[model samples]
Target: MKLSKGANAPVPTSLLAVVVSWRSEHAVDAHALLLEGSGTVRSDRDLVFYNAPRHVSQAVTLDQEPAPRTARLSVSLPRTEADVDRIVVAGSVENGTFGDITGLTLTVHAVDGAVATFEIEDADAVRALMFGEFYRRDGRWRFRAVGQGWASGLAGLVTEFGVQVDDPADPARTTHPTDPFRLHRSARTSPSQEVRSARSATGAQPDPAPPGLRDRHDLAPVRHFPHGSFASDPPRRSAQSAREDGATGLTSDDVVVQRFSSSDDDADGRTGQEAAHNRSDASASVRPRTDLLDRAETAATLGSYRPVDLTRHTSETAPAAPPPPPNPDLADWHSDPEAPERLRWWDGTEWTSATCQHHPPSNRHCARCGHPLRRKLLGGLAPCQRCELEIEEYLTHWHTQAWRVLTTHGPRGPVWAALWASLRYQRIDADAGRRALRAVALSYVERLVTFTFADGEVQHAELELFEQAVTELALGGPLIEDLRRRMHRGRTLSRLRAGDLPVVRTPGLHLDPEEKVHVDLPATHVRQLARGPKLTEGRLIGSNKKLRFVGAGAGTEMPWSRIISVHAEQETVVIAATSSRGGGTFAVADPDYVAAALEGALRVAKRLVLTPGQRDTRSIPQEVKAEVWQRDGGKCVECGDGHYLEFDHVIPLSRGGATSATNLQILCRSCNRAKGARI
Candidate 1:
């Protein structure tokens, strides 16, 4: 519908299109100012859109429609943006007043069709014209033909809308040439004049000047004087007249004035001497003081003096203050008065009714073997240094033996070893722990080993008989009934070895069942040592006093009396012995177990004596064997056979050669015999 000035129409949709067509005689620019619900612009929300240096909004955008005399503004109506509530469409003449524009029309269209239109006919003296506005009322939108005009141009409208205008003449005022929204001071008025005009427009009176200060416009003009210019010369008088006046002591009005001029000079050019003579004459005119005694008497009469007493004052001394008493509430642990050997606990505010008997401090020693603990084991209840190294060697041997038994004799060997060690060291009920071990071993066999129909699936009775046989061979059970009861549960052996499942403890195993066991057998010891990622899982088993390690796909063993030196290296323990050619090194997961085992092994090894034959036997140690095996790739060096290995002396013992690792090498039995025959 065509809308004239002051006309209005209801808008249906949130999205609306505004088209402005103006046929102006001069260049004119169309613009719009987005305002809030207050019908006013705020610094944070107000946005100005113009032709040059165009401004775009997320909710309202200017379309690139190809209409020569037209500008299109697309408004997104259903806007969640809380800041924009109204859009004011306006136009301004670039170089001429709005009166110079002929036909100016602004039309708003909804999706259906034309919603409203504003037309301006006479805009004389107006440089900016607000054509129409689209605003929100309640929950609905409406369009109004405002047709408001400002004679002071777009800048005036911008200032009226609360934008600050910078003085155009201010050199310090920064403005971007392409910024159309920047308001510039009007050329007709300076900043001060504009301020005055604003005050006048607001009906605010200027403050009155302070009293006695003339008005700025009413002040007299100051006169300027050139250099060496004089308004009038001083009143001329003769020096003789001045001297006569001085002799007569003339009155102030009759006194002669002497003038000194820069131009004064004698004909003989003696200006300096003349100046000196004049100064002397001036000095001679002053009267001299003749009464010295009279001057002294006058000074004495003017001066006042008084005598002060020179004696000291006396006063009595004050008494000293008393010291503070000791605190009664403070408490500390002290020897018991009744029993000097006992200590009594004392709470800070008062003493508690608790007393503890003190035990004499003993030299730290291995709890298991009673070997004197070294400085390295002094931290806690760790075993002596020897035990630590022995434990590592024992663990290595146990892991290898366990894996070998598991692969060769079936899981029964390792499972029996684990169960027996658990019973002996963990102090668990023999019958119950055996039952748990049997169940675990059965699970392990089922999971790891597959039996075929041809392999002879045994009946329950036969299976029980087989279990009895394994138990008798690996773990000595007294009778069949005891073996049956012990190996009946059929549980997984891995979980039992891992200690995730606990076995029933023997009754009266300790005074407190909850108390931790100080000494553990090889199985529990290795399990404790294999606690970290470096050592995944290991079992230490001891049979006939020989420790073996079974895990990590390798086995290691060392007699209890063979460890010479046991010490820790980073996270591992290294074991060296008088009998071994090289030391044994194993990763340490549980330092306590390593220390305990090493100390015990060392104590045993130190006390035990070997027969002269055993001691002097010219045999290569396991460490040297390992080195030779690796060096020879587990093959005979002479014949290159990978089996029937024998460590032969490179130089025969009869040839005065030392039985050392340097003289040792691996050879097949045939090669060794041939070499012996040749020697």
Candidate 2:
């Protein structure tokens, strides 16, 4: 049979099963409370079933099944050993209000096949509901459909029942009773005493206290007794009463009860009354003197009081005083004054239930911008609302730029500028920042050169392959060389000394008298030419007697007299000479003009060679020569001697070796002569 709200039914058998079911539309959780005689739970153990499940032997077992969204509790009255006098079944939505969910039902089954069902039709604004309770009554188990709810969910219910939740912020934290319920239970009056008190308050003669409860202070006084009891009999007269009853001497039944009276008490009462009257008369005499003194003082200060004109008075009410000004502190939530570590929510006029306990005030700032956080935005490190918005905007811009760069030739300058600015505010280590930059750069390179699946997504292996390709490219290109120079500039002096390089006072070059910069182009360190080298301030320079490179960290000069050959290849000018240091190569912004200037200064006979695939043994590019020279540090790589240094190709040209910096090596004249071309 279907049970209505507040309906009660008896449990006719020793064993019972209660099942609660709900639709999947709500993510509802189930809980069961084992209450004592009082409606509240006495301890955490009394809460039998929750997120953490437990079984109280074969007597009471709680189980939850997810397949059909149901929770079951089985109770065996015979084996139940705990002092649990009542069981309350409840359900709560995990993360939503119950007003949004529907189709909630609960059912109970007995061993004799008797069944009771309850349907919950409405639960507006409720987050948790107590569906029903089973209590022991009159030696029989009875079920009552309560259908009550709380908007504060399970946590509030736990607190209401005297359990102290350790951490309100963490719902899963342990709970325990604030104080034993037995202590409070001892102070309450018994049912019979309550009944007597009710009768006495209604003007009815109350029943006498039972003999067993007579000494208990919490019980009412004895008023009426049953007939034939000792309290109903008259008292026997003593010998003293007989002596005082001389005038009324008679048999015990005829003896009139002599009312006891005290002559000393009557005299004392009359004296107390006279003393009270005399004290009142003295107080009245002192009051007039006090009034005369007050009048004298008032007349001496401001003369006599003015007479009132009551006849001409008008009936008008004064305007109410203006309301007090609003308090600015109430506009924002702050930590509770009594509990400094816990936050308290203040809603303008009053405090609310909302509160938060996070990190101490010292650490409450934005992790990205270091701005003070008035409220928690996300994670442990609180971020102010404005900083949170800025962080989101920055991340979005970064992602958009990353996507664009990976797809096509995108503007990298702006991206780099943004990165530099972000470093000032973002709390990231130097290595992490560099890694992020490299990753973005590699991602772009990967999309530009690698093939993807049909859906345009690259696999892990494919991504690894692309990363390797980009890393290899970074080893020699302008990009890698620039990065290396930057890394060198940022390194400490210990690193430079460890490399066995001279610790120069200034890492920049000083220009010579006659040398002038013709064209300046920003250039990266060529591996074979410069190690930890700074940017060359002037890329291409001409002098009356030589060509010079005024670099920020180191300078190289090629005297016109020592120039054996000069070759122009694309945007590079290569020179081979007999100077103490092997000749250097350079990249110029205006390659053609630099080539012409070099030729005119050196008085070269042949026109500058500009075409590709020209095997000119006379000269190697200045960049290639500098790269080879710097790689060997102006010494022969084979012998480590600083004499007659020359640039030689590791792989001979006839063997299809490209005249690139990686293939070129520094050698002494003797070693070059020893290692002839294989052809």
Candidate 3:
């Protein structure tokens, strides 16, 4: 479809080719800037032009070969950095103004036949034109036909976006005619050779590299500027350039173009066939693209097809497709014979004791997750509308409290009911707690669901409760689907755990029927202070009874009650068993998770909570220390460093990990404090 200046169109694909075609001998070079939401380039590496032909992430690149005179930029939107807001497609003239050219059009081509073109009508004596921008809107990508230009040229344009380009006007720097000019000039520019320093916009020294990128002094010099810290480049003609650019954004990406035509039959009363033949080609200049084949023989051999005509000669009209059935998880008021004064709460599937009066107000926010209560079933929500609580905060605080409540009292039982009642949300009823209890209910239900799916199965009673919660909370299909996704992953993990036992070649491995499997992961035993070949490949399995590894010709078993210390060093799990043989360092999948499972299982096995060796405050619980010792085999579980030992929680206690043996582990001083908050 054709677009006017300031009008926009949706780019329908992640991969596209943006071609700027103009009628002129003047050299016009295409350039793109990866801008942050603050409307400035993140770094000089974000500038992709002839000087920097490829973006650091390869999200945008100037095509090495272009068709005749057109300039093309290949875009891979998915490869773009998460913080990158948009790609500004601009062009600079090294020789003449854009006014000297004709047919100035920017076209974007998708893999499919979707094409969007914007034509520049009035000519202006500008050195650069912002052809358009491929930007993100509500999570989807779109293009806005800016057709805005600046009189300050390419060097001035680069300076506007937080870059200190070697200015041509300074006379100290020589000009690089990167263009259609490259085809005729002696010197060709390479991104690495023509590189400018991509420092902070404030001209501060570049910040230290990200933690993951640090300590590798041999890596390439890609830079990042902190968000909200990029102060505008001073002495740049940004203000004056903005004044010359008159482009204004249009309403939306989904533009509709209507076609109105006057046929011969409708206008001059001629036949339909005559109108088509007469209008087939008004002039010889319009010709069929017969480049692919010349043979009419192929056309004769092709299959014949006809369009379906529903309005033509049918005995009866075809029934219109019935609209989809309303959502099963619907909430509406239903009449009750017993209470004529009030309608009963029909939570989609059944009559609920909750009255319409008990329903939360529209503005109520969840006290638990801090997510807003859905105002109505299947309705839209405010974008990014979240309360002050971060997800980590919820996990650490409210979620922990809820889990503790469940651990003390079984789900769907009387104690569980009492805990729900004691939620004490005081919103519309009094303080800021109206309808907040429902989020608590959701949280508790989530825990129950997780526990139930641990065995790879869900009871019918559990499904009913889940459905009731959905209807009561006015949840939509997407949220329901997400819950199902959680269920599926849990079930998959459970089944994999169950499969781990049968593969053990060591026939001595056995489990009582009551012993529930908690952890099952591939492991390789690491022998400390060994002569050679430290690893003994095996499968590590844990249950409420014991921790054991069974491999080719080797086997090791440690009863949970006999374990002393459990440690995680890097990617390995070490268990110090008091009377167990074959106990050593085991490199396993997610050592922390294995350590957690072992501690929890040990607590269940021993049923005791106290550390005899701990002579300190309650910060390191006595019960947790005892279990960690039993699970880790009475030594520093990490690195076999028996000295300078410390007790660590596999999953921090604040994040809902149990305080008993399950969460505790042993670590040496260096291993425990290696990663600060990241650990």
User: Which one wins on lDDT?
Assistant: 3
lDDT of candidates 1 onward, in order: 0.43, 0.46, 0.50
Off by over 4 Å in 2: 112-114, 168-679
The residue-by-residue lDDT of candidate 2 on 167-199, one tens digit each, is 535544422111100011112654345436656
Residue 468 local lDDT, model 2: 48
lDDT of 3 by residue, 13-103 (tens): 4788899888878777898988878888754557778745776567899986788789999999867765679889999886789989888
- In candidate 1, what are the lDDT values of residues 470-532, reduced to their tens digit? 554344334334434323422222112122222233243322323332222322212233565
User: Once superposed on the true structure, which residue ranges of model 3 sit more than 4 Å away at CA?
Assistant: 168-679
Ranking by TM-score: 3, 1, 2
Superposition-based RMSD of candidate 1 using all C-alpha atoms, in angstroms: 48.3
lDDT of 2: 0.46
- 1 versus 3: better lDDT goes to: 3
Best by TM-score: 3
Point out the higher-scoring one by lDDT: 2 or 3.
3
